[model samples]
Structure formats: structure tokens, C-alpha cells
Target: MTNPDDPRSLELVETELPQLRDGEVLVKVQAAGVNRGDLLQARGYYPPPPGESEIIGLECAGVIEDPGTTGRRKGEAVGCLMAGGGYAEYVAVPEGQLMPIPEGYSPTETAAIVEVACTVWSNLGMLADVRPGQTVLIHGGAGGIGTFAIQLCRELGATVAVTAGSAEKLETCRELGADILINYREQDFSEELKGKCDVILDIMGAKYLQQNLRALNEDGQLIIIGLQGGVKAEINLGALLPRRLTVRGTTLRARSLEGKAEIVRSAVENVWPMLADGRISHHIHATFPLAEAAAAHELLDSGAVTGKIVLEV
Candidate 1:
């Protein structure tokens, strides 16, 4: 892909594949996921970490060309959560990052699963330790992570509350089993949810910090994964102390290979079966061909997408 001065910098050009490194496998990409991070990278704001490919993609599902030492043979369909380089016709990924496509999913569906699944598993499941009967608040209810988080939290026995900018999006969240729907545009979420949130999955960083704190129940955990609002915020230790609240932040793109590998392992062992058995589902908003990546980015920027946008390779 081309890195240019414009937002529409994505270009399809012929490139040669490299020889596989240790624990890496060559995949013939079928479909890949488009994410907000990819858009930031397009605007020259987010670059790949050292040793990662400079291409702009985070997840993909494809057939294995060379499985390397992963114990799986060639030609098996697998999905991967990548550091970068899922926007191309092929990608070289660590074997541990690849999960066999869940039994009933298509390539496009499988492509959308890995990144969001691992993110929710790492933050909500592992870090926050969300429990049965807990009240969880998920911001951005219609987005890729929000939709999945709603379903996963519901399936795991948590009562879910979600915030979205529109009614249609909130309705989608309702289908995913979200119990409380707060239209952020029309409602003050902090007022609607005061003292009701046991766990809050937040993306609007500084903008919602105080409100999120106000909404949290005692011993609440707030995990901030995106900075859509602002980057800086003030934490009221006085309020946090009385509630015993915990606030944490994380990003998947910057994690070490070992950390990502462990997340992938846990998802494969735990979440993959849910997907295979129809307990979990992938939600796609739209798809564009590899050459139409610029248009995909345009749609993402419009902020109208209710779920993930995919690119067919």
C-alpha cells in the first residue's frame, strides 16, 4: 500500500513475499478487517511498531500457504490478529497468532473476529475479571469491539449497558443483548447510569473520564482502549479512593509478541468454540475490494458504520 500525503493513500501494487522466519507462516489472504487505527495510520498519525510491517491492517482470514512449525498443514483456513500488513494479498504471521477458522464462519466473518475477540478477552475477561451478574457499560455500542463485547458480556452473564450516537445503533446493541441503551447524543450517560456500572469499557478517553467515574459502582474497573475523545484527563483520587475504583489503559498494536501470542492462545481455546457453536457472531457493516481501500477509509471516517468494514483481498 502507498503511504502518501492524503487520506486516500491506499494503493494496490505488486510486492514480493519474503521467506518465512521462525514460527512464522505464509498466508494467502482472503479477507482483512479495516479498523480506526488503520485510518490513523493513513493520516500519518500511527505508524507500525519496530519489526512490524508498515502496511495498514490488523486482522485477516486466509488459507495457509506454508504452515511452518505450527503443527497444522498447508491449505487450512486460519484467522490472525496481526500487528500490521493485513491489507495485502498475503501476510506472514507468527503461528501462535493464527486460529483455525471457526466451523461455520466465512472468510469475511472469520477476519473480523480475531482482533476484537482478543481485545475483549484481554481487557474484559482477563484484566477486569468481569463476573456473572455484573453490570457492564460499553461505550461505542455499534462499533466492532462494542458489538462483540455486548454479546460476549451478555453470554458470560453480565447485564450490559451501551452508549451510541444514534437510535438505530442502539437498537442493534439491543439485538446483541445490551440491556440499557443510552443515546449519548440525547442523554447524559453519567446521569442515566450513576452508580450502576461495575465495569466500564471506555473509548472516549478524557472526555468521559469524570462521567465514567461517577457512573461506576464500588470496586469498579474502568478499561480505556481508545482515545476518540481527548488524550489528557484529570483523575479525582478522592472519588476513586472511596469507591476503590481501578482505571487502566491498553493497546493491542504495541504489545510484545509473547503477550499477543498468549491472548491468541486464550481466544482460540476459549472464544473460538463459542463462534463455532453459534454462541458468538461476527458483525460486518460493509466490504470493499483491496483496490478500493481508499473508499473504505472514507466510510470509516464518516462514522456511520455500525460494525466492521472488511476488505476482500
Candidate 2:
């Protein structure tokens, strides 16, 4: 399966799964979650963490083949984020990153749900400390993490506003509980949203920096999770300081195993109940076979998807 002719564009030739380490479990992957970073990694822009597998998928849902005395049981339905490599038919993941698939959810569905929940929970729920009735302006509201953020923030009693490229995507955001929709292509978001936001969750850091600052209310928090538009930015510290705005940035991929595991555990405890009760649901825009990973990358790169995309192995 590792040869050039193997037909899986995401996997390099001669790639092989290594023996499971002491705290690792082998997963028979049924589906893998696709993220924009996966495309970057395929193009050699993002490198896997040292000592982790070189395979390119960050998250997957599947059945456990062996638990390796890691407290996981064989045949347990589980989802996990790999340091690398989830596009393959099987992946060995550290036990710490593993979470059981919510009851009755398909592996394909669970694959799409896990990554978004973890990302939003860590950023909005844990870091930002979003409070009830506060307004959250989320950039890319129709994308994977944005969709989840809308639902999670609403569940926590925050008013959600989203910026998307189209009215159609905005409608989807509305269904997900977004109270305000700004079509960025047609309007200046900062000008439209001026003085309306209590918190801003941004992915296009530099592209939206100045305006994002302008949109915030006093004591607002700006949490940046991605630099989709480019990293460099110039900010007036006076604007930030006088407004009592807090600016923060983070990346989930570089986190320690323990930190990631704690996030997974917290999500299971606090957020999974919402899923079980149907208060939060996943929105899957499309699914592709694992072998057609390049096409999945193309779809995400085009920015045409309204929600999460998944790969069935």
C-alpha cells in the first residue's frame, strides 16, 4: 500500500505502520477527518512532530484492533488525532488521544465530529472563557470549526455572529444558531460589525486584524486559531490596551500528548452530553473515499465546502 502506484495520494511510497509502542493502540481506520492543514502537510508546508508517524491525517474514527494494555479494549469504537498519518487503512495512535465514538454514531460521522469539537472547545470554551449573552464574532462561520463554534457558543448562551463568503453559507450558519451574518466579500466586516463584538474568534489573523480590533467592545478577547490569510500584521497597541482587549493565538497540532488528551477528555465530559441530547450536531458537507484524498484536498483548497469533509477508508 505504500508504493507510488498505491493510488492514495496522501501516503508516501514504502510507508509502513510500525510496531505499537507501549501506550499505543492500533486502529483499523474506517474514516479520517480532512482539514485544511492536511493539504498544507501534503504540499510539504507542515511537518509531523518528531517521533510521530509521517502519515498525514490528524484525526480518524475507527475500530481498535489491539489496545496494547493501554486501558482500551479490542474492538472498541474510537476516534483520535494522529501526530501524522490517518489516511491509511490502519493507524497506531497513542492511547491518550483516544476517545470512544459516541453511541450509535457511524465511524464516518464520528470522524467529522471529533476534530471540530476539540478545536472549538479548547479555543472558545477553555481559553476564551466565553460567557453567557456575550457576542462572539467568528470568521469563516460556515467552515468546519466555525460550524461547531456556532453551536458550542450558542449552547453556552452566547450570541453568535459569523462571517462567510456567501449568503448561502450564511443561511447555514443561521441554522447553526448564528445571530449575525456578515458577507465579507460584499461588506467590510469591521465597518458593519463595529462596536458589536465582545469576543472575536478569527482564522484569518492578519487579513482581519485591524478591523477585528475595531469591532470589539471594551474588554473583548480576540482568539486566533489559524493564519489563513498570512501571519504578518501591524496593530496599534494603544487600541488594544485602551479597550482592554486580550489578543491570543494558538495551534492545536503542536500541543503535548497529555494536553491533547485532556482536551479530548474534557470534550467527552462536557460536550458529548450535548451531542447525545441532540443539542449540538455535526454538519457534513461531503465525503470522499480515502483513495481520492487529492480530490478532497482540492475541494477544501477551493473553499467551496460549507462544512466538514470526510474520507471513508
Candidate 3:
């Protein structure tokens, strides 16, 4: 999607296959995962990181086009974390970012898994170290990241709390084993869980900043991955100091190749087992053909999608 204001600007243009740099593998993409990062890039608010593709996609599933040294063999079915270009029929990714598809998963299903798994694992498990018995409060619990997080945190032995805008969505969260369900539209979420959270996976930014701090217990960590609410907000050091709180912000697309590779490594090692063993499954809210990318974005904007929207290429 090129134009920020109009989806019609997303024209499908023909292009030559991308050149392979050192440590890169060519992928014949069968599906791609749509993320909020793609939406922001469509709006021109988040452009590609330096030297990355202008095409708007963050993750994909495909077969390896050639033998590569990063542990993937030719013709292997793999899912890749991409900086961009997953929307195309083919994309070139750094070898370290490609991982074998989870056992028995289709290309489309596996496409939706990598982005959320890598994201939640990196922030909650690796960064915050949200261990067993801790309390995790996740906002936007019906989202791709939120759904994956609730299940992962629960499996890790944490009590999961989630805030969704509707009772129906809250029920879905409950089905996912979220212990505490808050209907944000009808309840004061911070008051409901004040001083009770060990970790908060937040998507709402400035709007929830203060309340997120209030929701934290001593030594709590708040990881901000999205800024849907707003960007800038005033934080009281007085409160943060006494609580010994930590606030960290991160994104997957803007990282260096090595950084993303490490995150993918951790995700494959830890999260892939759960998926392959049937302890966890990918949730796909909707699917669309590659040509109907705008409609997929429209579905995403509808605010009713329960999980991910995958584009079949």
C-alpha cells in the first residue's frame, strides 16, 4: 500500500526477483502475514528501515529457492521474518531469519505464527522474564500478539489478565485461558488490577501509560510494542522510583538483521515446540487473496478481527 490516505494506491506492480546478498536466501512466498506494522507503513508513518524493501509485509511462509548456509536446505518449507517484501510471490530474507515450518502446518497458517511468536517471546519471555506464577496483563487481548501472548504466558505458568473492548472478545480471551478478563469499555481496568501485575504487554501507548504504571507491582516491567493511543506522555518518576519499575519499548521490523535473527532463534527453540506438539495453535481471523490486500486492511480496520489476517499469495 503506497498512499497513506487511499488504499487504491496499493498497486500490484511487476518486478524482477531481488538480488541475493551474502547470507541471504530466496524464498518463493506462498503466504504473508499482515501486521499493524504494515498498516503504519501504508500510512507512511513508518517507512522501511534503511536499505530495506518498500513492499509492505513483515512475515511470510514459503519454500527455500536455493541451498543456503544458515541451516535451511533447498525446497524446505519455511517461515521467514521479513523486514518487508513478503507481499510478493518471492522475497529474499537473511538466512538466520528463516525457520522450518511447524510440523503439519500449512504455509498460510505458519505465516501467521512467526510474527506473533517472535514478538511475544522476545518481549515477555526474554526481555521481561515473565516466569511461572507471575501476573501478566495484556491489552488488546483479541489481537494476534495478544492471543499468542495469553496462551504463551499461561503455558509458562503465569496468571494471564486481558482487557478487551467487548464481552464477546473477553469470552474468547477466557477460552484462551486468560484468568482475568476486563471489558475496557465498561470497566476501569487499572482499578481492577491496580498494583497487581508483574508484567504488562501494552499496545495502547500514552493513553494507558499512567494506568499501566499503577497496574504494576514492585519490580514490574511494562513492554510497549504499539502506540495506537498516542506517543508522548508525562511519566511521574516519583511513582516509578518507589516501585522500581522498568519501561521498555521495542519493535521487530526496525532491528538489525542479527537482532531479529536472535529473536527468531529463541522463538523457534522455545515456541515452535508448543505449536508442533499441539499445545498451541495459530489463530487466523481472516484470509484474502494477494490482490485483495486493501480489503484485508479494511477488515483489520474494522476492529473486529480476533487474530491475524493472512494473505494467500
Candidate 4:
């Protein structure tokens, strides 16, 4: 039998505390966001990039535990979209990726907001150039990223359309400013939304690709941020040419520290204020103690969470 003192499984092991480098800040994690990438990593199908620690979480909010060659005062609360290791009691992030927790936001609330906001802003705000008056179609509209994307797109003056699995989830999306809601289980969304959108924020991949491209208006952008559906498929450039549609995909965990830090900088300058002033709120579905992270992951894996699942430390 494996000794509890030397647990070998992903969730049970307790290793020596990790260290921080120059330009890094050690966070005493209060809560961590459980993302899809964490699930993949725990299964050993994905790993943090080179130079990143082999821990499972991607983002967290916490108090500063140690400062390494940086000027951040210890005990100040901060939030970070990290490369890995956020599931622990402590995680180190480069100072550049750190931001003061949004004013009036507690660590748990900030934990729910940081990753989805960073992800949406990076892909929708930066890459796709989603602008006001453009219509955006978002899939998985009830998930963490979708909820944030719906609000941010609306805040940007775009008309928003979304597809969730149920009427209840659709109502939540609509409450968050979705102009149109499609229940995928009951209707053909792209068929219902024909020629209606100027941008598409897609989470389901190849399965929706063809119809999504058909749904875009001229000069439209389709940015795929998740592949909940299978990834491989053929692309029809012919369909894209006349509409000038842009189909692109991105993953946050694979990005470089510098790239993610740039995302953090932009989010703090832009999206953070919306959160601080109550124009945007983190959709926290539930919280569990740090030791219950496996259950949290199972919850996320179950597809029942309407928003983020957080592990409180």
C-alpha cells in the first residue's frame, strides 16, 4: 500500500513547497480556478510548458507570501493567471502576471474572474478585434469563459448570440445580455442564426465549424477557444473567401509568460474596472476546500457548473 506520507497520486501527493525566482511573487493561494487544462494535466495528457512547475491549476487569487526581487509588499492580496501549480496552498507567479485584486473583490471572487477575463480579452479583445456593433455568436454560453464573453461583448456594444444546452442556461446567458439564445439540444443554432453574426466565439470545434462559417457576415471573425467537440476536420476555404471570415483558435495555458503577462496588463487596465464598479461580476458556481480539488474537477468534468468552480485553500 502507498503510504499517506508518500502519496503517489496527483491529488494526494504533498511535495516540498515550490520556490520563486527573480521577478516572481509567491502567493499564499486563497482560492484557485479549476480549468479544463487542469483536468487534462491531471490525466497526464497535458503538462505545463518548460520552466513551469508540474502542478495543476492555471489561475488563482491569494495573498502575497513571498516577494522575489520585486517590490510587492507581503500580505497584499493579488490575482494571477498562472502557468501551473495554482491548486496548491502556494504558487509563484512572475511579478508581471500579478495584479492587485480588483478593489472590493475578495480572493474567491477574483479567482473566478481572472482566468476567464484574461482568456476572453486575449482572444476576443486582442486577437479577433471584436468591436462595437459587431454581432458575436458564442458557443457554450453557460460556461465560465462564455459568461464573461457574453458580458464583455455586450459591454463593447456588440450584439450577442449564444448556444447553451438547456433553457435554464440560456436564460442565464440572456440575463447576461445575450441578444439571442439557442438551445443546442432542441434547435439547429447556425441554421436559426443564418447570416446574423459578424463574429463567433466558439468553444465547440469541428462539429460546429462548417455551420459557424456559414453563419458569419462579411468580414466576420470566428475565434475558437475550446475544442469540447473533436478537433480534427477539413476546412472549406471556399466558404470563407466570399464572406472574408476569419477562423482562428487559441489556448491560454500554452502561451508564454510574456504573452500572458501582456494579457494581464491589458485586462487590469481595461476589464478590471468593469469588475470593480459592478458592471461585471464573477459567476462563481461553487467553492470547495483545497483538499476537495478532485471533487471540484469532477464537478467541472460533469458539465453541470454554470460558472467557475473554485478550490478554497
Candidate 5:
């Protein structure tokens, strides 16, 4: 449970195992992925959806300990995309949110990839329908989501551009097939790529709103998945109408069970093959024991991490 007075206070305490509802299974978690959202929850900025666990984790890889009403056998390894409760040793997951572990990936690796795979695929594939020969820009390209998105856009035969705060981070993005790299600390990404981007996967919200609009080409799409900079930006309606641009903001955690299930299914059908065939890979920047989750969150919050962080249970 989060402390009202001290948002960053995290402690391990004994709690009863979650009771499973219909079509849900109990998972013995092996590892859980750490995301920016988890840090927000820790700081009391983000909270779990109504009727969901208040535990601070969004995704995990584990074995089914109790299959509940689902037909799956116990002890099957699976990766779960969750609304909450992944930090615990055991979590109740709707069967539809469970994904088969990709071939050749361990529980740790599976944990690293599940949320990112589902998130990127759902936005880039389902929402934008990014096509080949397009120019895609991804902000925060050194982070887990950006790195994964770089490879996916490349696999789709699009030119990839990315922005990071440091040269080293930009280099990492380049190695992952990024065609253009802009160091946001030193360069103006909007000025550098004006009217060139066909699709932009943005994490910075209000701070980059106008700049992102300036960077897009006609019929361009700007998909906002995070608000690290801020929220509540003023948009120019005139610019959007003349350019035929689209700005969409989405959060996966608040989606319904059926919605998340569809994303999981589509991610498995499309992105899973890329993982299996080695067209894309999971990058785990660091790992910590569940007891050191505070340290893990601190490291990720530092903005120096190049990829995903995992908390092993």
C-alpha cells in the first residue's frame, strides 16, 4: 500500500493472497518489469484502476499456480500484461491478459518485453497503422519503449528518427537502426526534422506539443503515450486542419479487460514472431531483487537507463 504522507515509501509486508474471480488465474511471479508508470504510482501521481490491486507493477512473467476457471494447466509459464498487482509473489490475472512466453526467452526476458510489446504494438500497429516507407520519430529513444519501437518501425520498412538527452543514448538508438538522431539537449528536433515525420511516438506531453506538431508531415500521426514533461497543452486547431494531422493520447492501464485482451492477442500474433525470429530483442539495462525495488526505481528515475529494468522475485 502507498503511504499518503510519503509517496516514495515502499515496504514489504505480509498480505493475503489475492482471491481469483471468474476467468482469472493466480500466478507465482518470477519477475516484474519496472516502468515509468510504476515510478508515478510510487510518487502518488498515478494510481491503479478502480477494482484493481494498488500494488506497483504493470507486467510480470510467472507460472500459473492456480488456473481458476480457465482451462490452462497449472505450472505453465506465461507473461502477463496487467493493470496492477505484479509486484507481489502471486497475482490474479485474467486469462485473456496472459501471453505465451516467446520462444527462447526466459521469465526475466519475458517480463521485460510483455508490457512494451503490447504497448508499442497496440499504438503503432492498431492505432496508427504505420505503413512502410514512412518516416517515424520516437522520443526518448534510449528508454525501453523507444528502443523497442525503433526496431519495430525498422522492421516495417520505415525510416526511424529518435531524440535522447545524450550522445551515448543516441548512439544506442542508432545501433538499433535509427536513421536520424537528435540530442534534445543540444539540438532542436523540430527544427532538424521539420515537416518530415510521418508518425511520431511521443512521451513528452505539453513541453513538446507545439514542436511535435511542427515536425510532422501532412497526414501525420502523433501518438502520446506518456506525459513526462507535463499535461495540458494548447494546440493550434488551424495548423491541424490545414495539415490533416492527428494527435492522440493513450494509456494502456486504464483500458478494459476485453480491450487489453485484444491487444495481447494482436501482439502475440504479430510482434511475437519478430521476437521469435530475432528481428527484435529485449534489452534489460539492470535487475534488482524485489527487496531492492526502491533502488531500482531510483536508478530508472535518474534518466540514465538505456533499456528496461526488472525486479526479480
Candidate 6:
């Protein structure tokens, strides 16, 4: 739990095991994934949904310790897409949010894959309906979501373009199948991709709004998943009208239980096969012991990490 006064002060302390509700199971967590949303929660900017756990983690891989009325066998290994509470030793997971671990993936790898896979698949595959021959632009291409999105887009037969902060990061994106790489620090991605992107996956929020609009082709869609940049921005309504452009913002954690369950099911059905066959690979930049979660948060916040971070229990 974050301290109200000093939000960055993370400490490991004993807490009661979460009680399982109907249709939920108790999972003994093996590893948990660290995400930018955790950082925001620690900073008091993001809060878990009502009636959810106060713990920071959003995804984990674990064994079912108590299969409370879910009919799942105890000791089953599962990857969990969570609303919250994944950072602890034990978490109560809704049965619908549980997924089988991909073949050839360990707990840490599974932890790294769950949240990003569901997010990317839900937005690109389900909502945007990304198709072959369409161009997709991803911001922060070297990060966890960006890297996963790049490979997934390639698998969907889309032309992938990415923007990263450095040439080294761009190279990483290239290796992951990004067709066009723009170093955002050196090049204006919007200018380079003007009216070329069929879909733009944006994390920068307001800072990139106008540029993202400029970069979109007619009838393009912009999916804003993160608000790393400021959230308030003025948009020209006329511009959107003439271009038939659409902008939608979404958050997985805030969705209804049924909504999350649908996403989890879709991700498992579609993305798990890719993971199992190595078409889309999970990337873990680093791992820290669960107790060193503060340090892990610092590392991710430093902007040096190229992929996901996992906290091992």
C-alpha cells in the first residue's frame, strides 16, 4: 500500500491473505509484472478501482493455492490479468481472469506477458480491427507494450512504425519487426509519418495529440492508452471532421469485471497461440526480489528500461 504522505516510500509488510469471493481463486504468486500504472499509483496519481486491492501490481503468474468454488484444481499454474493485488504473496483472482501459462514460458515470462498482451490485443485486435496492409504507429516502441505491439502488428500483417528516444532503442524496435523507426528525440515522427498511419497507439497523451492527428491517414483511429504526457489539450474539431478521424482512450483496470473477463478470454484465445509458437515473445528487462519493489519502480521510472520488469517472490 502507498503511504498517503510519501507516496514513493514503498515498504514490505505483512498483510492478511486476501479472501476469495464466489467464482474466485486464491493464487500464491510466483512473480509479478511492474508497469507504469504501478508507478502512477505509488505517486498517488492512479488509484485502483473501487473494491479492488490496494496493492500495486497489475499482472502476475502463480499457482492456485485455494480454488474457491471455481472448479480449478489446486496447484494449477496460471497467468492472471488483474485489477489490482498482484504484488502480494497471495491474491484472490476472479476465475474468469485466469489464463493458462503459455508453453515454454516460466512464471516470470508469463507475468511479463499477461497485461501487455491483453491490452494490445483488446485495443488492436478487438477494438481497432487492425488489418493486413494497414500501417500502425506505436509510441515508446522499446518499452514493454510497444515491443509487444510491434510484433503483434507484424503478425497481423500490418506495416509497423515506431518512435523511440534513442537510436539504440530504435534498433531494438527494428529487431522486433518495426518497419519504420523514428528517434523522437532527433526526428519529428508526425512529420515523417504524415497522413500515413492507419492506426496510432499513443502513450504520450496531450503532448502528441496534434502531431498524432497530423500523422493519421483519413479515417484513421488513435488509441490512447497512457497519459505520460499532460492530459489537457485543445483539439480542432474541424480537423477531425474533415479527416474522419477517431480518438479513443481506454484503461483496462477501470473496466467492469465482465469487460476484463472478455478481454482475458480473447487474449488467451488469440495471443497465447502466438506466444506458444514464438511468433510474439515476452521480454523481461530486469527482475528484482519482491522486497526491492521500490528499487524496481525507480529503475522503470528512470526511462532506461527497454522491456518489462518482474518482481520475483
Tens-digit lDDT track of model 2 for 208-232: 8999999999999899988888899
Residue 225's lDDT in candidate 5:
97
Error of 3 at 251 (Å): 1.2
Local accuracy of candidate 1 as per-residue lDDT tens digits, 1-313:
3654666767787777856888999999999998988888888888999988888899999999987776778898999988998999889998878888889899999888778999998998888888899999999999999999998898889999999999899999999899999999999999999999999999889999999999999999889999999999887799999889999999998999899999999888878888988788999999999899999998988989988999998
Q: Rate the local accuracy (lDDT) of all candidates.
A: 0.90, 0.87, 0.91, 0.85, 0.94, 0.94
Please give each candidate's TM-score: 0.96, 0.95, 0.97, 0.95, 0.98, 0.98
Q: Which stretches of candidate 1 lie over 4 Å from their true place?
A: 1-5, 69-71
**Candidate 3 TM-score versus the reference:** 0.97
How would you encode candidate 4's per-residue C-alpha lDDT over 1-313 as one tens digit per residue? 0222221234546777888788898899998988877776776767789989887788999898888789889998899888898989889898888987888988999899888999999888888888888888989999999999999999989989999999889999999999988999999987988888888888889888888988888888888887878788798898888878888878888887788889999999989899988888889899999887777877888889898899898
Error of 1 at 248 (Å): 0.5
Q: Residues 165-279, candidate 5, lDDT per residue (tens digit)?
A: 9989999999999999999999999999999999999999999999999999999999999999899889889999999999999999999999999999999999999999999
Which number leads on lDDT? 6
CA displacement after TM-score superposition, residue 58 of candidate 6 (Å) = 0.4
Query: Which candidate do you rate higher for TM-score, 3 or 6?
Result: 6
Q: Sorted on lDDT, highest at the top, how do the candidates line up?
A: 6, 5, 3, 1, 2, 4
List where candidate 6 sits over 4 angstroms from the true fold. 1-8
What TM-score would candidate 1 get against the native? 0.96
Expressed as tens digits, the lDDT of each residue in 1-313 for candidate 6 is 4564444579899989898889999999999999999988888888999899988899999999999998999999999999899889999999999999999999999999999999999999999999999999999999999999999999999999999999899999999999999998889988999999999999999999999999999999999999998899999989899889999998899998899999999999999999999999998999999999988988998999998999999
* lDDT agreement of model 3 with the native: 0.91
Q: Give stretches of model 4 more than 4 Å off.
A: 1-10
Residue 108 lDDT (model 5): 96
Candidate 6 similarity to native, TM-score: 0.98
- How far residue 116's Cα lies from its native spot in candidate 2, in Å, is 0.8
* Residue range with the least summed lDDT across 10 consecutive positions in model 5: 1-10
